[model samples]
Target: MSYSNAQELLSAIQPASGGTEIFDPATGELVGRVAQNSVADLDAAVSAARTAQPAWDALGHEERNRLLNLAADRIEANAEALAELLSREQGKPLNGPNARFEIGGCAAWLRAATAYEVEPEVVVDDGETYAAKHYRALGVVGAIGPWNWPMMISIWQLAPSLRMGNTVVMKPSEYTPLSVLALGHVLNEVLPADVLQVVAGGREVGEKLSGHPEINKIMFTGSTPTGKAIIRSSADTVKRLTLELGGNDAGIVMEDADPKAIAEDLFWGAFINTGQTCAALKRLYVPESIYTQVCQALTEVAAKMPMGVGLDENNVLGPLQNKAQYNIVADLVQGAVDSGATVLLGANPDSEAAGYFYPTTLVADIDPQNDLVTKEQFGPALPIVKVKNVEEAITHANSLETGLGASVWGSDREQALAVAARIQAGTVWINSHGTIDPRIPFGGAKQSGYGLEFGLDGLKALAQPQLIKG
Candidate 1:
C-alpha cells in the first residue's frame, strides 16, 4: 500500500521506543527511534534465519524468483512512501537522482536478479568422464549496509543472496535505520517469514553478526576501516565476505575535450547525492592547458544546481547525512585552502545553520599531495588538480590505495580506453563516471575491498560452487 507522507510510512514500520533516536539531517528534527539491538538480538535473528533457510531454499529457484518479483512489485506499490521516508532519514532530496532514484534502483536490482539465469554448467563431457559445476545456497547471509544509499545497496546485497537460496539477516547503519526498516517492512510483505530479517543495532551487534558462526557470508558496504574490522572479525569463523568499501574515485579530463559540453555531467559526477557517494568523483586531474576553462565550466554548472531541504522539489542537492560527515568535508576543504589552493566555488558554510549543509565546493590549483586529493573526502567538495600531461594525470589517479571506480574523459574513444587501462579501479569509464548498471559486474581493486556485486557473477558470489563428476 502507498503512504501519503513520511509519517504514515514511519508509523507503518512501527519505530522502536527507548532506543536510538534518529533525526533529519536536512532539518535537525526528530525523525524516529530504532531498537538498539544487542548481540543476543543478532543471535536470535541468525538462529531464526538458520531455521527458515532450508524451507526457503527448498522452494527452489523458480518459486524464489517468482516471490522476489512479487517483492519488487510491492516495492513499486510503496515507492512514494519509501522515497519520502528515505528522503527525510537520509537527507537526500525526493527529486533528482536522490531518494526517488534510489527507490527505483532497489526495484530494478530485484527484477534483474529474477531475470538472471542460474543453472548447473557442464565443464566436461568426455567419453570416459563427465563433470559439471553447480552453485548451492550458502545458508545465511549477513548484510551490513552503510548510510549512503542504504535501501538500494541493501537490496543489492539482499536480492542476490535470496535468489541464490540464502536467508538474509541485515544490519542497517545506525544513522538511517528507519529508511531500511521501512523498506524492509515493504519487502517483507511479500517475503516469507524469517527469510529476511532487518536487525537495527549498533557496532556490537555488527561485530557479533560478522563473527557469527551461523552466518555463511557477509555482504557489507561501508568505510575502509570498518571493512578491515570485518575482515578481522570474520577471521575466526572464516566467513565468506563481499565487501564494497570506501573509494576515492578520480576523473581525468583530456586537453582536447570540450569543458562546456561535459559540464553538467561532470557536475553530477562529483556532486550527485551531495557527493556522499563512495564512487562519486572526489579528485579531478585536468590538463593544465584547459584547467581554467574546466574550472569555469564546472563552477557555472554548480551554481545552477539548487541545494536545500530534502522535501523541496526545486532542490537537486541536500545537506550532508550527519554532522561528523559534514565536519570531515569541512576539514578536508579547509586543509586544501590552507595549502593555498584556490576555491573556485563554495567551501564556506554558516556554523549557525540548522542542518549539516556543506556548500557544493570546487577547489582548483590544488597540490597532488593535498589531503583533499589524497584522502577520501566523501562529500560535495571536489579538488581539481592540474597536470602537465596525460601521464601525470594517470600517475596521480593511480596513486591512491583505494580504487573502487575511476574515469577518463576524452573525445577519442581509443585514447580514453588506453588511459582507462592504466587506472587501478574496478570499473573505469570513458567520458562518464559513477553510473552503474545491474547487468554489469561491480567490485573494487586493492584495499577498496573485494568480491563482485550485480549481474550473474554477483549471484555466484553469494553461492557455493559444487562440482559433480563421474
Candidate 2:
C-alpha cells in the first residue's frame, strides 16, 4: 500500500494483537497508532528472519547489491510523501535540516552501501598452496532504531545488513515507527517476503528481540543505558552487537577562532534536529578570552531563525519529539539557571504551549559542575563553558563518560587538528561538528557504545570472516 501521510501509513500496518497510539509532537494531536508487539510477535519475527536468511544469503553479493539499489530507487521515488509523514511524526521542520534532508539521507546511505564491496582477501598465493579470507553473512539481524532521525538511522543499520545478505527484523522507536513502517512498505515491494520486516512496539519487544537466541546479531541505536541493557540481555545468547548510543558530544572553540565566521556552523551543530541528534554538539567549550563574543554571535544568529511546528516551511527549529524529552531539557536548563548560569538567549518555554516547543537556548557562564554542563540535554538548548586554554578545553571535552563526537574550531587548521586529536571521540572535526559521511566509519568511544557504522568496516561488521586454506 502507498502511504502518503501518517494516517495512511497507520492504516496499512497490521500490528500483532495490541498497540499504542502515536501523536504529532508538533501539534500534540493524535496522529496514528503503532502495534505494541508482544514477546510472541518478536519471536515470530526472529523465526521468520532466521528462516529467510539462507535464501537471501544464497542470492550472492551482486544480486543483494541490485536489490538494495532498487530499494534506494524506491525510497527516492517516495521521498516527498515520506518527508511529509516524517515531519509530522518526527517534529523536525519541513525545511532547513528537516524531513526532506533525512529522507534524502536515507537514499544516499543506501546508494553508498551498494557501492561498498567486501571482496575476499587473498592471504597466500604460493604455487604449492593458496588461502583467502572471505566475508559471509550473519543470520537474523535485529535492528532497534531510535525516534530521533528514525528513518536515516534505521537505514544506517538496515542497508548494510541487507547488502551483506542478512534478513532483518527491525523494531523502530514507538514514538516514530510510522515512517519506518512506511519505509518497510516501500522496500517490501523490491525485496523478498520476510527479508525486511518492521515490528513496532515498546521496550518489551526490544528486550525480547535482543535476548532472543534465534537472532544472530543485534544492531541498536539509542540511549547508553538501554544499550547496556541490551548488551546484558544478549550475553546469554552471545549475539553479535553494534550499538550507536547516547552522546553528550562537545565542541571546543580556540582563542584564535572567529566567532562570527563559526557562529552559524556552531549554532546548527548544537541545534540540528532541534538538538535531538545523538551526535550533536551538546556542550561547547570556548576560550575565556573570546567566550563572551562567541555567545553573542551565536545568539544573534539564533534570533533570526524561526521556531514553530514542523509543517511550516518558515520554521527552522521544531518542537521536542515528546513530553518526556521536553521535561528533561526544561529541568536541566532550569537547574543550571538556579545555579547562576546566565541565559544568553532564550528561556524555559511556555509549558502550556500547543506543542513541546523549547526555544533554541544558549546558557552562558555555566559552572563545570552544573548538570546542564555535565548531562546530555537532548533538546534545543546548549551550554557554553569558558576554558583557560586549548589544553583545558581538551581536558574538559574528554572528561565526559560519553564521547561519540567532538570538534575543535580555530583559524589555524594545524592547531585545530592537534587539539582534535586529543579529544576522546570516534569522530573529530577541525572546523565542523556532527557532519558525517556515509563512506566514513562512525561509532562511539567510552560509554558511547561500540561497533562501527558506515564504510567498509561497517559492512564487514555485519558479516563473518571465513578463512579458506589449501
Candidate 3:
C-alpha cells in the first residue's frame, strides 16, 4: 500500500492492542502509533534472524554484494517519497538542509557499502608455516537507531551487517520509526524473507534486544547513559557491541580565523538537525580577541534563516523532534541566561505555538561551568565561550567526558592541524565539524562509548576474525 505520511503507514499495519503514539513535533499532531513490541516479539525476531543468518553467510561476498547493490538501487528509486515521510515524522525540512539530504545520505551509504571488499589477510609467510586472518559473519545483529538522522543511521548499521553476510533485527527510535519501517519494506523487496526485520517500540523493546541471548552483536546510537545501560545489560550474554553515543562536541575558533568568512559554516555546524545531531558542534570556544566579532557574525547569519514546519520548502530549520527535548533545550538556555550569559539571538520560543519550535538560539559570554556550556542540549541552542588562548580552548574542549567529535577553525592551516591533533575526540576536523564520510570510520572516545562504524574497520567489527595456520 502507498503511504504518504506516518499516520497512513501506521493505519495500514492494523493497530495492535497496545502501542506507543507517534506525534509530529512540527505540528504536535498524532501522526501514528507503533506497536509496543514485547519480549516475545523480540525473541521471535532474533530467532528468525538466527535461522536466516547461516544461509545468508553461505551466499558469500560476491552474491551478497550483488543483492546489496540492488537494494541501494531500489532505495534511490524511492528516495523522494521516503524523504517526504521522513520530513513529516522526523521534523527535518523536506528541501535544502534537511530530509532529502538525509535520504540522499542513506543511498550514498548503501552504495558505498556495495563498493567495499573484504579479503583474507596474509599475516605471516615463513614458507615452513604460513598464517592468514579471515573475517566471518557473526550470527544475528541487533541494531537500535536513534531519532535524529534515523534513516541514514539505520542504513549505516543495517547495510554494513547485511554486506558482511549477517541477518539483522533493527529497532528505530519510538519517536521516528516510520521512515525506517518504510526503508525495511523497500529492502525486504529485494532481500530474502526474514533476512532483515524492523521492530518498532519503546525502551522495553530496546532493553530486550540488548540483552537477548540469541543476538550475536548489538549496534546502538543514542545517549551516553543509555549506552552504559546497554553495556551493563549485555554483560551476561557478552554480545559484541558498536555504540555511537552522545557527544557534547566542542569547536575552537583561533584568533586568526575570519569571523565573516566562517560564520555561515559555523552556524550550520552547530544548528544542523536543529542541533539534535550527536556530533554537532555543541560548545564553541572562541579566542577572547575575536569572541564578540564571531558571535555577531553568527547572529547575523542565523537571523536570516527561516524556521518552521518540515514540509515548508523555504524553511531550513524545524522543531525539536519531541516535547521532552524541546523542554531540555528551553530549560538549559534559560539557565544560561539566568547565569548572566548574553543572548545574541532567539532567546524566546512561542509558548502558544502548535509545535515544539525553539528558534535558532546563540548564547555568548558564558563561563565554562555554565550548564549550557557543560551539558549536551541536543537542540537548536549553542553556547559560545571565550578562551584566553589556544591552550585554554583545548583544555575547555577536552573537559567533557564524552568526545565523539570536535573541530578547529583557523586561517593558519598548519597551526589548526596542530591543534586538531591535540583535541581528544574520535573525529577531529580542521576547517569543518561533523563532516562524516562513508569510507571513513566514525565512533566515540572515553565515556562516549566504544567500537567503530564505516570503512574496513566497520566491516571487520560486524564479523569475527579467524586465524588460519597451515
Candidate 4:
C-alpha cells in the first residue's frame, strides 16, 4: 500500500469536495488540500470509534501488537513519500533531523508500544487473600496534535491508546493536516476500520472534540494557552487528559565544560527543526568565564549549517512554518536588539523576501528578564545570557513557570547530575538537550502540563486500573 511519490500519497488523502489549501512556507507554493471536516465529521468519527472499541479490545494484546508491527513495516516502506509530504507541509529540511527523522520516530514509537509489557500485576499473595491489578482500555480517546511535529505527535497520542485497546479520533492542526492525513492513510492500510480516525479542521472542530461526552480521555500537545482551553472545555465531561504543552527550555554551560566540544551539540539542541521544536532549547545560560568562548563556538557552528527550501539536499534548516510564526520570531528578536543585546551572528531578516526565511540568529548579553528570554519565541533564534555563577543560572532557568525540558552541560558527570537534579523541568538532560527516546518516559512540570508519555507509564495513562481480590 506504499506510494511511489508524494503526489500519489497526497491523492490518497485529498477531500472529495474542495477544502482548505495548504502552502509551503519556504516557497509559498501550494502543497495540497485537506478536508476541513466539521463538528459533525468529528462526531461521526467519535461514534465510529466508540462502536469499534469493544471488538478491538476483544482481539486482545497479541493480535493488536501484530497489527501495529505491520503498520510500522508499512511506514518504513512509504518513508520517502511520507518524508516529502512532511517536509513540504511542515517546512523542515528533508535531509536533517527534520522530516525523515520525524517519520522514522513515528514507526519506532509504534514498535516500542508493541514491545512494552503491561500485563496484570500481582499486588499481594498471602495464603488467605490475593489481590491483582489489571489495566482496561478507556473507551475512545481524542487526540489533538500540534503543527510542528504533526505525524510523530499523533502517533505519540494514538500508539498507546490503540495498544491499550482504546480507539482514537485525532484532530490535526490546520497548519499541517496533510502530513497527518497522509500518515493516517498509511497506517490504516494495516489497521481495522474505525479504530483510528484523523479529522483535520479548524478551532471549532477542536473545541467540540475536547468536550465530547463519548470520548473518555484527551491527549494534546501544543501551546500552554490552548492546553488550558482544552482543560476548561473537558471539565464537564471530566475527561482524562495528558497534556505536553509549551516549553521555554534552558541550557546551562558550566565552567568546567569545553565550549568548543559542547558547541555543536548545543547548536543542534536549540536549532534542530529550525528551532520549531516544543522542547528544543530556547534560553541559554553561559558562565561569565566561558561565555565569550561559548558564543563564538556556537556562532561558528550555526554559520556552517545552511538554511533554504526543504527539498535541497544541502540545507540543514528551513523557513518558519508560516507567516504568523515568522512574524512572532521577527518581533521578539527585534525587541531584544532594541534592548541593546549584541547580535552574535544574525538578527537581520529580509522582510521583502519571498519566503518566511529568518536566518539562524544568536543574541548575546541579553537581560535575564528580556521578553525573548522570558517568552516562548519558538524559532531559529537563541538568546545567550551571561551568568556570574551556576546558582544564578539555575535561578534564571527556574524563574519561568513553563518547564517542559532543560539541560546542564559540564565535563564532570557528577556536577552536571547534581545541577540537573535542581532544575524544575520534567526531564533534564546532561550534556544534551531534547534527545527523546521511546524507551524513556517524557512529560512536563508545573505550568508546562502533566501526565507522562512513552514507555510503560504512557500505556497506563490511556487505561483504567482494576483491582481484583480473591
Question: Candidate 2 lDDT (Cα, whole model)?
Answer: 0.90
Q: Model 4's lDDT to the true fold?
A: 0.95
Question: Each candidate's lDDT (Cα)?
Answer: 0.93, 0.90, 0.89, 0.95
User: What's each prediction's TM-score?
Assistant: 0.99, 0.97, 0.97, 0.99
Instruction: State the number of backbone clashes in model 4.
Output: 0
Task: Please write out the lDDT profile of model 4 over residues 24-129, one tens digit for every residue.
Answer: 9999999998878889989999999999999999999999999999999999999999999999999899988999999999999999998888889999998988
The clash count of every prediction, one per candidate, is 0, 1, 0, 0
**Model 1 regions lying over 4 Å from their true place:** none
lDDT (Cα, tens digit) per residue for candidate 2, span 150-222 = 9999999999999998999999998898889989988889999999989887788988999988888999999
Q: After superposition, how far is residue 371 of candidate 4 from its true place, in Å?
A: 0.4
lDDT of 3 by residue, 1-470 (tens): 34455445455553665567777889877766667677788889889889988999999988998898888887777777788778888998987668999988888898788777799999999888899999999889999999999999999999999999899999989888877888898788899999999998778989999999899999999999999999999999999999998999999999999999999989888989888999999999999999889999999999999999998899999999888998899999999999999999997988899888998999988889999989999999999999899999999999889999999999999999999899999999888888899999999997888899998898999999999999
Residue pairs with backbone overlap in model 1: none
Instruction: lDDT for model 3, please.
Output: 0.89
Ranking by lDDT: 4, 1, 2, 3
Q: Residue 46, candidate 1: how far off, in angstroms?
A: 0.5
Model 2 alpha-carbon drift over 4 Å, by segment: 1-7, 14-19, 126-129
